[model samples]
Target: MKFTATQTGKFSGPGFTARCVLGKGGVVKASQKREGDGASPAGTWPVRNVFFRPDRLDPPVTSLPLVPLKPYDGWCDAPDHRLYNRPVSLPFSASHEKLWRDDHVYDVIVELGYNDDPVTPGLGSAIFMHLARPNFEPTEGCIALEQNDLLTLLELMVPGAEIEISF
Candidate 1:
């Protein structure tokens, strides 16, 4: 199965469609994507895995591999770091984003296989499909969707599903 997200804020799968928000800088070609550029990379990225906050919600219903998030979970985004674009433990001495956010946004996260193929440095990192803010605000560099909509999409997604993002 394949899902798609467009620049117009539309995210749709086989039978469901929901509004979504992209990166603040909008969408850009994968080659043009850079660290901290605030743009969603354009390409079909596989769904690597799902991470959910076990403290806040029960495990989500989906066919995708699921991991309960730990408070120490983090993703290194520092371009020059060896662990760039990879998950690292907290207190990690490199720049990273805390998967355990104070906000509800990261309660459920869909890890997108962006820039992780060979872990290119400075190409961008931590690109995920996560819960959107109440007003559907733009993300720093990830796709955002409402909680229910995201869960629905997850339910429809299969193990080998990929999300095709376009500008």
Candidate 2:
């Protein structure tokens, strides 16, 4: 199954008509995607493992590899760092995104396979499909979906499923 998103901020997959909030800058081609651009890169990317907050909710049922989010977990977004575009333990000296967020947005995260192959610095970092805010606010460079809708998608999704973002 594939999750496809449109420029209009709507997303569709095998059995769902879920609403998604795109990046504030909208969607762009992968070549145009830059670090902190706030625009989702257009292309098909594999669905990697999932990260969830155990304290807030039980682990979701899914075939994809799922793991619990630790308080000191984070994603290194600093382009200059050696671990750029990679997960890092908190208290990292370089700049990184703290996975332990109070907003609950990071409570459930799907780390899409974007820029991770060889992780080019300044291309982008931490592009994920995560829980949306109450109002479905625009993400930094991720696709945000409502929790229920996301849970449904996760349940039906298979390992190696791809997310296809188009123009």
Candidate 3:
């Protein structure tokens, strides 16, 4: 999959067009909100991993790529912290943080390789591709689509799938 930013929006608070590529399911319009700045970051990124609801009878899995969930999993957005662009557990003090809330959002996620320069602290963390709201509304820095579409994309995905967003 590949994404291109056809316009500008905010991810971490900056202008960036958020054009995304669905998993062979085509394109779906989505929205994002920056953690602090409320500006969407624009650029090329990769699908790092995938997660789904464990309580589900049979959570969907595909060749796109998968990563297990841990109690300590978290996404750090503290641009000022030493581990700014990586995933960190609790006991942290970052200004902008995604604590991997037990909510459905993180329950099914696909981490994006935005600023994953070295992969250690990764580029801005917590980017994912998960279920969208019934209204097909915007997101808080993640891509979203209909459940069926997502499932289809997952089935057609492979590890190292490329996601590009252009403006």
Please list the residue runs of candidate 3 whose C-alpha ends up more than 4 Å from where it truly belongs after superposition.
Answer: 1-35, 56-59, 118-125
- What digit string (tens of lDDT, one per residue) describes model 2 on residues 1-167? 78897768788988878888878888899989998889999999999989999999999989999989999999999998889999999899998999999899998999999999998989999999999899877889798899998888899999879998776
lDDT of 3 at 146: 56
Cα lDDT, all candidates: 0.94, 0.90, 0.54
Name the candidate, 1 or 3, with the larger TM-score value: 1
Q: Tens-digit lDDT track for model 3 on 47-89?
A: 7777665554146668765566666666667766777767677
Please give the distance, in angstroms, between residue 123's alpha carbon in candidate 2 and its true position after superposition: 0.2
What is the C-alpha lDDT profile of model 1 across 50-74, one tens digit per residue?
Answer: 9999999999999999999999999
**Total clashing pairs in model 2:** 0
lDDT of 3: 0.54
Lowest summed-lDDT stretch of 10 residues in model 2? 1-10
After best superposition, candidate 1 residue 155: deviation in angstroms?
1.0
Candidates by lDDT, descending order: 1, 2, 3
Model 1 has a clash total of 0
Candidate maximizing lDDT: 1
Q: Model 1: clashing residue pairs?
A: none
TM-score list, all predictions: 0.98, 0.97, 0.66
Supply the global lDDT for candidate 2.
Answer: 0.90
